[model samples]
Target: MEIAVVTGGVAEIERDAGQGSSMEAEWLALLAALRLARRQGLADFVLLGDAAAVVAQANGAVRAPGAMAAHLSAFFVLASDGPAPRVRHIKRTQNLAGIALARGR
Candidate 1:
């Protein structure tokens, strides 16, 4: 899982690969950000992810599957008005904290 906390152009990203396993851990991070952004009433924010799910969810064009599907389904219950969160695919080297977190997890 990877997280990029940003207020403006500046952001600090934290990441970890849980069990040092598959990339699914990264998806969890995206899910966490989606949940957080929705809770924060964020009409717009920047998100970093290696998967397309972040972009798809923000655009309301794709739905999460498996265990994450349920939470993602509930998340959209709120009004996600305004532009969707900006999603940029970042390299692992740029997502330090996220990489670390995924590993730790």
Candidate 2:
């Protein structure tokens, strides 16, 4: 899987994700981006992704399935370490990270 991060409309990180289900990959990408933001000392930022289910689960709008429960928990724990996390769902075309990944392919 391909994972990418874009900040301020610029590509900040891109990487190949190891083997996992699509849901797991989405969670991994979100986690990776949050970790990077924390390292950069960012206190306020919004995370945008094309995965609607992951975003909904992250925002507590829905409950994650059993396989994704741990990931949802981990996201909350990591997000609590800094400012409140704002995760939003966007169309694939509106996601820069998705665009970048497409270009890489």
Candidate 3:
């Protein structure tokens, strides 16, 4: 899987998701993005993704599957360190990270 983080229409992070299912890759991407934001000391930011289920899980709108529970927990722990970033779902066409990954392909 290809994962990417885009800021200001530029790719800030991009790499291959070594080995995982699509769902796992999505969670990994989100975790990586949050880690980057925290490292950069970003206080206010929103994470946008095309994965609705993942977004819902992150926002507490729906329960994550058992397979993803650990990922959900890790996400919460990282988010709790500072201002929790909002995770929102957007259309695939509007997802910059997705677009970046597509372009790279």
What is each predicted model's overall lDDT from 0 to 1?
0.55, 0.86, 0.87
Model 2 spans > 4 angstroms off: 12-15
Write candidate 1's Cα lDDT for 14-96 as tens digits: 55434432335545566566666766677767767655664566456776667656545544543244445566677666764
By TM-score, the candidates rank as: 3, 2, 1
The global Cα lDDT (0 to 1) of model 1 is 0.55
TM-score leader: 3
The C-alpha stretches of model 1 lying farther than 4 A from their native spots are 1-21, 51-83, 102-105
Residues 1-105 of candidate 2 have per-residue lDDT tens digits of 667787766775546577779888888889888988898899988888899999999999999999899999999999989899899999989988878877877
Q: Count the backbone clashes (under 3 Å) in each candidate.
A: 17, 0, 0
Shift of residue 77 alpha carbon in model 2, Å: 1.1
For model 3, how many clashes?
0
